[model samples]
Target: MTEFQTIHPLGDVPPQSVESGDTSGITLNVRHEISMVQIFARNGREMELAKKLNIEGVPGRASETRSFTAFPLAPGQWMLVSKNAPGSGFGTGIAKKLKGIGYVSEQSDSRVCIRVSGSQARELLARGCRLDLHQSVASKGFCAQTPMAQVGVLLHQVNDGPTYDLYVYSGFARSFWEWLAHTAGQFGYSRGGRGH
Candidate 1:
C-alpha cells in the first residue's frame, strides 16, 4: 500500500509583508480548509434545485451562512463552498443531496480561495478587475465570474469591509498570487494565516 499527504496549494510560498511605511492597508490569506463544488441545475429544474437546497432561486447573488456559501456563476450554475476538514467528502455529500436535480462537480482540489480584505482591498482589485465595485453596485452578497490578471476567477464580495474571495484555478494560483503581491505593494499588505 502507498500513502500520500495532501499539500496546500500555496504551502511552499513564504508569508510576505510589503509595507509602505508604518501602516499596512491590505491583508491576504490563502484559505486552505475549504471545499468547493460547482453545481449546474438540470435544464428547467433551477427552481427545483433551489428548493432542494432551501435557498432562493438562482439569482445574480450570493447566499452565505456560517456553514456554507452558494453563489451564482451563471443563469443555472452555482458554486457551493464550505469549510471542511481534510478528506471530509463535502462534495460527495452535496452530490448526494442534489441527486438528480443538479450536477455537482468537486472543485476543492481544482480551485484556490484567496481572501483579500482591508480598507484598500477594493482599490487593489480595481487595478486589474474591470467590474465597477462601488459599494452601491457590489455590496455584500454580490458575486460574479470575472478575469483578474488574465486569470479567470469567481469573485465574491463577502462583507462591507469590501473584502473579496477570489477563487482561481489551482494551476494559476502562484501566478495570481505574484500579480496580487505586486499590485498590492503600493497599498502595503500583510500576509495572513492559511486557514481559519
Candidate 2:
C-alpha cells in the first residue's frame, strides 16, 4: 500500500528564498489537518451547552479541554478546533456527545488554518487586520471575527508570542495566502511544515 501525505493549501509554493536584506523573523505555515466544527446551541441551551462542553469564562474567548479548543463566535455559536491526530474525531464525537443539545457540523475542510508566529507576527498582521493585537489588550486565547485584506477571517491569539491562527474560507485561501506572503515579506518569514 502506498502511504499518502497531506499537503496544505499553499503546499505547492516554495519557501520564500529572497533575502530582502533582512533576517526572516517569523514562521508562516498552514495547519492542514486541524479538525474544525461549527457548533450551534439548541434554543435556550447556551449556558447548558457551555457547561457541558467545559467552556470556561466568557464569550469572544477560547476555552480548552484535553484535546479541543472552543472559540466563541457569538452568544450561541462557536467554532471548535482540535488537532487532527490519529484517532482524533472531534466533530463526529462532539456531535454524538451533544446529540440533542446542539448542532455540530464538520468544517475540517471548509477552511484553511494558517499559523503565524515570531517577533514580527503582530506587525505583519497589522498591515491587514485592524484589531488591537497588543498582548496587554488581546492577551492569550483572545479571538475575533474580522476582515483581513478584505477577506472575512477568524483571528485567534494562541499565546504570548502572540502567535495567531487565521481561519479563512477555503475559497479565498490562495488569495489570502498571496496577500499574506506579500505583506509578511516586509518583516520576513519562512514557510513551514504541514500542521499538527
Candidate 3:
C-alpha cells in the first residue's frame, strides 16, 4: 500500500527572510494543519449551541477561548478554529459536542491561516485591504470578512502585538502569499517556520 502525505497549501516554499539593514518591520508565519469548523445554530437553538460550546451566547464578533477561536459569519453562524494535530478529527469532536443544536461542517482542508505581525503589519495590510484597521477601530478580538489583494479573507486581530490572522481559501494561498511577500518587501519582512 502506498502511503499518502499531506501537502501544505504553500507547497515546498522555504521560510523567507527578506530583510534590509539590521531589522525587519514585519513578520509572517504560516499556520499549517489547523482545524476549522463552520457551525450554524438550529432554529431557536442559538443559546443552546452557545451553552454547549461554553461561550457567552452566539458571538457577535470574534471570540477566543483556550481551545477554540470563533468568528461570526452571519446571524447564528460562525467559524471555529483550533490548533489540533493533523487528522485529529477536531471537527468531528466539535460536531459531537454540539450534536443536534447546531450544524457542523469541516473546513480544515479548504482554508489556510497566515499570521502577520510586527510594527508594520497594519501598514502592509493597508496597501491592499480596504477595511479600516486603525487601532481605535480594529482592536483586539475584532474580525471582519474583507478582500485583500483581490482575494476574500477572514481577518482576525489576535493581539495588541498588532498581530493578525488572515484566513484565506486553500486554493488561493499561494497567490495571497505572493501578494503579501511583495507588499511586505517595502517594510522588510521575515518569515517564520511553518506551524509556528
TM-score of each: 0.87, 0.85, 0.87
**Residue 30 CA error for candidate 2 (Å)?**
0.6
Writing each residue's lDDT as its tens digit, candidate 3 over 65-174 gives 88888998877788999888647988888888988788998888888888888888889889999988998888898888888998999999998778899999999998
Per-candidate local distance difference test: 0.81, 0.80, 0.81
Report the error of model 1 at residue 44, Å: 1.5
**How does model 2 score by TM-score?**
0.85
Q: Whole-model lDDT, candidate 2?
A: 0.80
Looking at model 1, residue 52 earns an lDDT score of: 77
Quote model 1's TM-score.
Answer: 0.87
**Per-residue lDDT of 34-148 in model 1, one digit per residue for the tens?**
8888899999999888877766544658887556799877877888899885369888888898888889888888998888887888999999999999998889888888899
lDDT of 1 at 71: 88
* lDDT per residue as tens, model 2, 125-184: 999998888777888888889999999999999888768899999889889988997787
